[model samples]
Target: MSKLTPLGSLPYPQPTDVADVPLHLQSLAEAIDGRTVLRFTDIANLQARVTNPVAGMVAWLGTPGRLFHYAGNHWAPVAPGPVHKVNNNEGSTTSTTFVETLTSATGDPMAVSFTAPPSGSVIVTVGAYTYNSAADGLAYMSAAVRLGTTVKLAAHEDRSSIVRSAARVSASTQFQVSGLTGGALHTVTPAYRAGGGAGNTASFDNRFVRIDPVT
Candidate 1:
């Protein structure tokens, strides 16, 4: 009697089975390594600064914005100076004072972000509200850009104030701007509460994000 193997071939240490050897050859698959990969250098950053604007435009890229810090927030030339940095609330707050400088006593809050404007332009949106203690009211606010006492850019009634709780529900306004530079001095233009801080606690988050190039 002969011993049998699983494939009808005699079992051997390394499959040296002799009983079931094929007369002809069979296609064998080559062993493949575990991973595939690729890599390349990033050129977008340098391309714009070095290459012509037309070439950068062909790639659908635009000139980068001027970056700077102001009024306790980060700003970029992309949106003039209305946008804000991550920690817009340089300080904390916990009050109902109708003050513009968002602080803890006046409700430190964050502003929603906006799209960057085309080169040489800035824009911001704001709403207005009445200084009511119990419920929110419709009041107007102003956004102005200034440089050492000189108002370089101005947008009125751009953003509206809201009850700390209602801010998430209300729609935001936008301020359009042009003729500004990242190197210039600027601020959110300011939002003045018409009446005054009502007993009701209304908070404001005038923070914004600006996107542009690094120069």
Candidate 2:
């Protein structure tokens, strides 16, 4: 009997087969990866090519070239299309504590301006910073999120730690807004309010905000 063997590398290899014409006497990786990249016009055509496919086998659809993995006797989509994001982080502003609420833009106008991603929801976070002695812990800093004058989210946190330093926090608040129209420029801003009307000044640290899509 003549012993079968693979005499060359794949994609154009010579094989003296023991029944597996394209995979005879090949290495483990070559034997598995060599003969399993099946191509077809679509799902229907793929079914016509092989009556039974082993689990994990892939089919590359010819029309759009999307890949699918076989499982539970069916081919399922195996690729995540894409992800998108939007951000705004710039400038700085102080806070004026009073009986009224404040917008994020007033503190740091640049850090609050962002364009919404096409027709998708976004997760937003805003930060309120305070510069205190850590002992004057009497200073209360609050931050809020707004889109073109619409208040989407708002929250407040307090800590008088003046330790003669600045601190940043989310004030235990976050927002998730949906139904964004594609290509629309929405101005996002973060504003702040301290304890005393003009008496309480929020330093630049209180004006930080971030926004990103939920996709």
Candidate 3:
């Protein structure tokens, strides 16, 4: 007779039991037969080792230190990845065409880059302190969050004639972008434009862009 482990049901001989080599071998086989998680150096190593992983199989990736679970056809992250953020307060613009809110002295757009998981989604949040130049009609500032050149979220603030000219306001927008290519680098930028009126200068300061990858 023997006692068995509560979780894995592994058998161990008791004081009263006779020598049981077959039972001991069976217990050893069971111990290593079904592992809860497999460890690998990285994604390339994991794919090389696990060519035909089944559903619900879990793996630990060493390079990025993340956990992944196989979901029948593809490997999915067990949890959301790290968040990325960028902040700038040095630039202002009055361009009617949408342009980067943060830019270098060389006129290059400032951006935040992050790696996305396979078929994953990211939540993007963009915010800025905005100023609109005085005008007889409506004075407005329009801002947007862009994934590369594609605009994902856009927001605007309109100051009416009664609200005083040259008003400063806070504009922000948050949204999710999905269907991203797995293990690809993605960039996010905050952009702005002036309202469709003459002398309606739109300027932004103290702006930030945050990206949160979702599993």
Candidate 4:
């Protein structure tokens, strides 16, 4: 009969029974420690476990392949895995609001602003809504992702559809960019110009933007 030593530590502290040997080994595969095991748990449960966590504590979450490590403050995915971060503003209004400074209350930026990870690249998704048949009774909208003043992604509605105002429309697009310096700030925005319609005098509604990084 033999007992087992603690995990990740030196060998034996003579066990009192041979029967416990198989049980201890079974637990080793199921738990993180002798008392605590973390396998497939949701993000909420994962956060609850490490309420007073230290740096470098890691666990598999939500599924077998989803591994996360707890840094001092938050949980970060294990290396070689994609990391996602999102910033968005929501509300309702009836007016022409174009991209400007990041006045979230008014949606001046019309996009999500974020700090780039050390990866120097990220993918951005832009979403927005607007209603304006004002100009030529047609409404047009455009969107872009920018690394500082340099535009990385941009798109606009065709004049026929956008310029001729209908009901509000969901404007969404995505783009990937590289060569950015990690830890830099990036922004995405919505815009309108003289495209398919003279609908420059239209109105706008809800808008949002998001960015994801794959390193």
Candidate 5:
């Protein structure tokens, strides 16, 4: 029986421990640097071909997001469509207070004609503002929709005279005006007075929305 012996093991040179070597396989402090940094060969290429690139952009880079920094550094929810402003300044003019007293054909008089939400009837908010400081115009004057002889909604004070000066508030908003009889021969009585005389003309431009009946 021939004695079986293990094949001679090749003795290869062993690499020395780099822990004691100064610059042998050891990364230099200058190469590492104190500041943390990530090297990228081609950012745009990686982004274009990267998986879930859109998600990466949203997470890493502040881009391709719906939110925006509109007013300040804080992020705000972006509106999908155009923003609608309910009111705007109509300017001021030297004029008298134009008071209109609306009457119901049956003898009950009211200012506005809004009863239901979807109805064509709308409530109007009339505000009086200063026209000219030189004219000593009224500072603040306002009124709201009145349904009948007794009911007055959103009542505000006329802090200053509305006649013979530039009115500060020429803006108005539409509200639902209802609860009164419709098609009752509504009549409106217009009256105004300037600072000097009863015949003085007062002018005011109001902002109003067109009434559309919803079926």
Candidate 6:
């Protein structure tokens, strides 16, 4: 009698069966033809070798050490993209209108730029240590995450005689932007503003921004 392996169903001949050696060998060879991951030097090599790849077929590229799988129409990476982070602790704004946070004395905005993946969303997070100069009445400080001229996320906190004057508070905002243009460069910026009183000031320090891409 003969049975088949559980996974690939390769032929397994019993000792009592006495099957022909050539027949068993041919069956095994046919069953194992496309059972292993195809290896190539790079994407070009993979494309040259595999012209008619079916869905679920996987290939390993040597140059970048990435695994790709065919999705019936295109090949996609198995791993997510890398994360980007930037930090700055210089400069402050007192305007009531939202503006880019400066990272340097020369007025460089606290911004981070990265390339967006072909088909995925990006998550942006901004955080800072906030300060309001006014002690009496209500004072508010707002922080926002911006992509170009668009504001992705914004949040504000009010401090009205809650604690001692000039106390520092933490303000942060996070947003996920989807349907981004593939292979496009994206710049994320953090902004801040102040309101609720005359001669009041809002300041930010120890600012940080992070970007993550999901595919």
By TM-score, how accurate is candidate 5? 0.24
User: What TM-score quantifies how close candidate 4 is to the native fold?
Assistant: 0.43
- The digit string of per-residue lDDT tens for model 4 on 7-49 reads 5542332545455766666555544452343564666776675
Worst 10 residues of 4 by lDDT: 95-104
Winning model by TM-score: 3
- What are the per-model C-alpha RMSD values against the true structure? 18.3, 13.0, 6.7, 9.3, 22.6, 7.8
Better of 2 and 5 by lDDT: 2
Off by over 4 Å in 5: 1-110, 117-124, 127-134, 139-141, 158-202, 206-215
User: Which numbered prediction scores highest in lDDT against the true structure?
Assistant: 3
Question: Which segments of model 3 are wrong by more than 4 Å?
Answer: 1-34, 101-122, 135-168, 176-187, 212-215
Ranking by lDDT: 3, 6, 4, 2, 1, 5
Return the TM-score for each candidate structure: 0.36, 0.36, 0.58, 0.43, 0.24, 0.51
Evaluation by TM-score, superior candidate among 1 and 6: 6
Off-target runs (Cα >4 Å) in candidate 2 are 1-108, 133-173, 196-200
- After superposition, the stretches of candidate 4 with alpha carbons farther than 4 Å from their true spots are 1-105, 134-140, 143-164
Mind giving the per-residue lDDT tens digits that candidate 1 earns over 1-215?
A: 23334652442323443434342112111111101111112224533333332211112123333332221122223224344443334222234223445445233323233333334455555543223333443334445555556666543443443333333333345545666554443454444443334444343343433323223
lDDT on C-alpha atoms for all candidate structures: 0.36, 0.47, 0.62, 0.52, 0.30, 0.61
